[model samples]
Target: MTKQHIGILALLVIILPSCSYFDFSPDLRFCDDFYVVVEEMPVLIGGMAELQQKVVYPELARERGIEGRVTVQFIVNKLGDPTEVQMVRGIGGGADQEAVRVVKQAKFEPGKQNGKPVCVQYQLSINFRLEN
Candidate 1:
């Protein structure tokens, strides 16, 4: 087995789930209704240290030499639960699935705009690295 780390970036954070599950269709009005360019981005409830403890590096990924960053896009609702998790880019060999698993289980603080909690789109990248 190897060591891995998860890095997250808040690119294109929309208001919330405006479309169906995993459906990021182009609808100009959707942004106004549910999307929000949040001023205060969501945060992991317990921080990265908590996430690091919960993440399980898939053994399959380690044995197969599948290592890299897996970028996942998802929506964090006003209640801070991640939904509609989507893998924008992945390294494959179970790394993608594992990334999704971690994101789904992880909780956020819920993005805010104008001092009110709102939904937002989120992207997180989990890196798979082999121990030397």
Candidate 2:
């Protein structure tokens, strides 16, 4: 084959793999990763106060006076369901698990990317304070 033909074939091999046509491959870069930021971020339907109300303060935590903030990280999917819920910061005393549970039960208005719903990584902090 001519050198020109060989060069073209090599170039195509390098570029084609990155094209959308080959997105089905197992390459992580081609995967539809959850966006950290989007054109529109997901919103909790009833606002933060509503979410805080849903939280049932852990009895163990209250007994121990474990009062602080628990931060949770989760993925808000295209369907507005919270998935992959996890605690990013915790004060222990069952607070971590409680935080995760509350976040898991919560639903959001799915984030938008280019005006279309998409999965987005979201973080929220819930404060735990004792009544004075």
Candidate 3:
């Protein structure tokens, strides 16, 4: 072969090895039933007396005797702790406080991501009922 042809072949050989170094292989898993079931327990409310005490029953609502529901969202940490409680839906008076207080005081079993327990966002709904 001509020197020029030989040099070209040698250059191709040098470039091929470098190209192999960039080869990527990714791990993949497949399952016929790729479904994972997660069972969530019901969050307990009215368990903390301190939280109950902080709930404000609006005098106006009490006079009118309005009973409603409040929805709150929060994060439960990997340590099975609750934090960042905010009211998504609020009812005037002590209902909102009651919702926040109860949520903050409530404990969670934490949540799982990929079968491992991790911090997760949780939502809670609290109902305020006034007894005559």
Best-performing candidate as measured by TM-score: 2
Q: After superposition, how far is residue 11 of candidate 1 from its true place, in Å?
A: 51
lDDT of 3 by residue, 18-116 (tens): 896665443121112211223553234445454455566667768877789889977666556666789999877767776887677676565665555
Candidate 1: RMSD to truth: 19.4
TM-score of 1: 0.70
Cα lDDT for residue 41, candidate 3: 31
On TM-score, the stronger of 2 and 3 is 2
Best by lDDT: 2
- lDDT string for model 1 (1-132, tens) is 223222222222443455356676553222324444689998889886776566677888888877798898887787788878989999888888888998889989888889987778888887778878
Off by over 4 Å in 3: 1-60
TM-score order of candidates, top first: 2, 1, 3
Residue 6 lDDT, candidate 1, scale 0-100: 21
What C-alpha lDDT values do all the predictions have?
A: 0.76, 0.87, 0.65
Evaluate residue 11 in candidate 3 and report its C-alpha lDDT on the 0 to 100 scale. 100
Error of 2 at 102 (Å): 0.7
TM-score per model over all chains: 0.70, 0.75, 0.55
